[model samples]
Target: MKDTQIKKLIEAEKKRQKKAINLIASENYVSRDVLEALGSELTNKYAEGYAGKRYYGGNDIIDKIEELCIDRALKLFRLDPNEWHVNVQPLSGSPANLAVFTALVPRGGVKQEDGTTSVAGKIMGMSLDQGGHLTHGQKVSATGKFWQQIPYGLDPVTETINYDQLREIAMKEKPTIVVSGYTAYPRIIDWKKMREVSDASEGLMMVDMSHIAGLVAGGVYPSPFDYADVVTTTTHKTLRGPRAALIFVKKDARELYKKIDKAVFPGLQGGPHANQIAAVAVALKEASTPAFRKYANQVVKNAKVLAEELEKRGWRLISGGTDSHLILVDTWNDGKKREPLVKDAAGKAEAGAGAITGKEASERLEKQGIIVNKNAIPFDKRPPADPSGIRLGTAAETTRGRKEKDFKLIAKKMDEILRK
Candidate 1:
């Protein structure tokens, strides 16, 4: 508190967040208890390993804190202790994903002249610009560097994932793992179907449900727990927790679990953030309550109402509608004369609506206190620098107690800015 400059900036940020209409899909507001835990004295500790198995001393209490966090994570998520092993120590989702890959993939299968191990496998995930996260084996990510990326995209017209096509691709690629869930696509994922594909291809099923983890907890979204071999989720998104991630492994794979723990500790990270772990514990406890369930349900309700209102004003949403907490809207050239239909880089047809580029639309919205991010629509002709879609989510606003009517009003405000 003595640092006036930092304190002032933090205060300003709090005020700014209070006034901004937050719609970024990957963001949420944590409760005061969670915030307090984040700033607690636990920050000074360096717990290099799991509970009661640390290389560093003075970590007995840190062990208890982490154990509590992992326990709550498993309990809150309804994972049976007999069937699951949870890892709460990956810094965030990206590293959590990397840990999973390192744990599951056969590393050091080949050694080059440099005396370093070479890892090789196919990681099948959704395409990044088409709704996948970068860590899902995108060429630009390290995961892609280590493994061949076999990416999938939504059907150019319906905008839903073509599962038959996905299975065919999986059969051909014989991927080491198949990832479900996404960063931008709004429709619910068919986890069971993904599991089917994974089984058919003899691949591991990992659902990166970071965006919908809270929705899964609240019983709104389809839970991947029963199907995925590994489930990775960030605690912050719809979970309304700290910026931490949880990696869940099915109990049947005891061998894989051992590999995962090693990857998280000595292989990928060291001295896990005890304070963040404690905050994650608090947030997990909060997420387990009946009140949080109501909040999660309301988040979906608000998103639906907002999406409907936006559509009423000419915003064409991907997949026609959303069954989750987010919405992806196409916002490319509003006035361009077009043929009956448009095509993509693959010559596949796409159906959608008009002018302001996603970035320009976002800039205009920000000036009006509405926060959103530019995103690439499936087969978007425009480049990433200026994509054809804007992504929105209701998690933070719904957490602030906004409801269907509030979101409808927010949609009207967005209409005023984007309708031009």
Candidate 2:
């Protein structure tokens, strides 16, 4: 296409992005500097390996950039820069988790030479409904199909992970890997407590900090690096980087690190997207700045303010509150009411609303220039397609320089629609 056509497309996309009230938990706005790096000349090169060792020649500049990224990641995580190792090449979060699992699990299909599976006695992670990711061994996931999965869950009333119950499950199941982190959860994970559980269970604790990575980086949330054996995160969500993922392995897990690298390069993906890596580097650098810290703080503040405002307006919230950038709004009364009000309001709105239920609410919001996703609350009986709750986060809006005032406005709009 000609430059004019390209310019038009860019402008149109920018306009679309700017107009929307992006409340999706997994979304965020990246800096223009990061965008520039993503679209740089690095896209043309193919660097198959780490900084120093590449399969092809002419990687001198790329090597330095990659090394700088590694160093910055280590620094952000408060690890010894020389001792820490990170693989900044994963395509995204799911693949990164898969790579971590592949690395930790014994090769040759988890079965030993004696015709017995090595992981038979080992447990992995909690279930999806229990606030764990698919890689943490949901039955539909490849991980569950291959290895033993011992599911854990949150307390029915508290709506938070029952650490005591989790310990009991860990002790009884004796999992080889205890995965920490979550996708839809809105509170802070106790990595220290999780580390203790992993030690007691003789398992490795891998923390998927994909959601709160920016908060962790900005020092607003606790870093899991101090306790986790392995850490994985997406660069986009809270990090405000490219749509990519990263795997950080502790120094002692050198063998595991090699396995992770091999799994990423050979088992999962081929040549790395050098452009994304460059963007990640720029983002990491940005994350280390004071401005990013302010942004992280604002994300949490906005979430709290939004949650409080919604609650005061009679909207039921999961956990009754939130500590991170996300909040789960319960539309149905303990999964009893169908909530026709949501549909009525969406229908009456301009451009129509997104969806009626949390699912429909999300759809309706998108139609009205606001964006969010429906989510299943704890102890939910419904399928994910039409859950009783909508998940909203402040990362993107905060990145856009929004504050508690903006959150209050968004909350009012959401209340007007859902509580009509």
Candidate 3:
């Protein structure tokens, strides 16, 4: 009976995916090959340590698979094998970030023999109002609660990162870590400049590339490996793998590597989920192919076209445009006022204004088989739960083979709903 219920739930989920246009930025669809690897017999084993030095026996096969994954990841990032180390053991993106923090911060200010100090410092990244992820330093996240999190906001007039201001903040604060990544941001990051700031401040540069890892892998975006000391990413987003995460470290950080492995195992989690690792391996292999490059290019192209179409329809877009798969739409304009009146006058409810909130707007669109999440806008007057912005992306749609033509249709549908 339990197995039967699980099967039914999977069927329902498939139906939902098939019927809806999922535009959420942090979501994607994995291929069957990756899913099969996730359900393989590797989950039954318990390999506690790195490939060659496992705590348990019968780890030869697991080690080979992990090594393959690490090799592919290193190749994808164009890293020298001798100068880089890959840990394919993290359970998810959040845990991966925690591992990075634990490895970099010393326990009681004791400096390591490698000349790298363990002093804890502030983590600088995008502010909540500027479309940063919670892990980057939102007040509610563990990263914020435990560490000193200093946020850098967008230019008030342009709604984009002000690099000069960021450098000013870094010089003033002298943080130990500078993070460059986002969840809703739609522009290409200037990692080279960020690396310069991190160097001047004596800080380690880390990038949470969970949203654009596939793009980086596909050569659609600049690779952070050349400048970042460490990188964290979720395999599911744009990568189209299972729900897992990855942590890549520079080869010079040997002491840091040991600390990260320990933190991932004994410090934060127990046994590593071997199934997820297998799926991640499959996804990494898939990312190394030429076909994935075409997909990544399409994701950006689709986003740019969609943003233009929406703006042409009189929708206010934050940042003027996008260079990535996601875009932020401000919904507090004069045109949005037509929503409540259309339902009352026609005696039939409009498709997207039932509760008179962004959350309600999201729900209404979901009912029409178009999905998006209400997100907080910069300098938003509304609360986080019902912010005056919506975030849409092309990752999932691109995975489903969508392109500019599909986005034009989607923008038209969204415009009609917003106008009503």
Q: Which candidate tops lDDT?
A: 1
Indicate the residue-level lDDT of 410 in model 3.
93
Q: Write the per-residue lDDT of candidate 1 for residues 166-221, one digit (tens) a residue.
A: 99999988999999989998998898899888987899999999999999999899
Q: For candidate 1, list the clashing residue pairs, or say none.
A: 83-251, 333-355, 334-355
Clashes of each: 3, 8, 1
For model 3, the stretches where C-alpha displacement exceeds 4 angstroms are: 106-120, 333-357
lDDT of 3 by residue, 193-298 (tens): 8887787678889999999998898888888887988899988998888988888887773456667778887788876778888888889888888889999999
Stretches > 4 Å off in candidate 2: 1-11, 107-111, 114-123, 335-356
- Candidate 2 lowest-lDDT run of ten: 346-355
Candidate 2 at residue 222, lDDT?
91
Model 3 RMSD, rounded to 1 decimal: 4.9
Per-candidate Cα lDDT values, in order, are: 0.88, 0.82, 0.82
TM-score: which is higher, 1 or 2? 1
Error of 2 at 280 (Å): 0.4
- Predicted structure 1, TM vs. truth: 0.93
Models 1 onward score TM values of 0.93, 0.90, 0.90
Give the Å error, residue 43, model 1: 0.2
Error of 3 at 76 (Å): 1.5
Residue-level lDDT of model 2, residues 1-420, one tens digit each, is 479988999999889988988899999888888989998899999888777888889999889888888788888777885566798889989889878877776533566679885544354576676567887777787777666677887888988877878888788778878988888788889998998888878888889999999999888889888788889999999999999999998777345778888889877897788888889999999998998899899999999999998776667788899999989877765545433322334464222222246777777777788889888878877678988778899999998888888889999898777644
